[model samples]
Target: MKINKEEKTPWICDKCNKELQLSEIKVVYLGGSFEVELMQCPECKMVLIDETLALGKMIEVEKGLEDK
Candidate 1:
């Protein structure tokens, strides 16, 4: 899924109070790793995984790996 930072409301980091920027982050799951653009805090390096993503692509990938 493509997350356009410009189209959505900006997310704030709870710890750093910094506005989250769209960043390329490394994601690891079921022994697989890949880069995905996500909302992140520059200061604390915190990544936000929204519910839709957690329940959507991530879940699908997890099931696919399990089936493999």
Candidate 2:
């Protein structure tokens, strides 16, 4: 099956709010939800990593709790 490419979403630095265009950004899909993907803002390279890590931690915590 052919996957339709998603239109690029506007990306901004979470700390500085710097805007980035598609050419200046990198996206990695984790095979699911939008948040599961890594979005790197070239202008700052801040929001993407920061948000991804935060989400990763949240997932970890939830998994740990569930394993109990």
Candidates' C-alpha lDDT: 0.86, 0.53
Worst 10 residues of 2 by lDDT: 25-34
Superposition error at 38 for model 1 (Å): 0.4
Model 1 bad stretches (over 4 Å): 1-8
Off by over 4 Å in 2: 1-9, 14-36, 49-57, 65-68
RMSD of 2: 10.2
Please, what are the lDDT tens digits per residue for candidate 1 over residues 1-68?
A: 98877796679999999999999998887776767889999999999987877787788788889899
Question: Which has the greatest lDDT?
Answer: 1
Query: Against the true structure, candidate 2 has what lDDT?
Result: 0.53
Q: Give me the candidate number with maximum TM-score.
A: 1
- Model 2 lDDT per residue over 21-64, tens place: 33333333332222334555565665345565567755665666
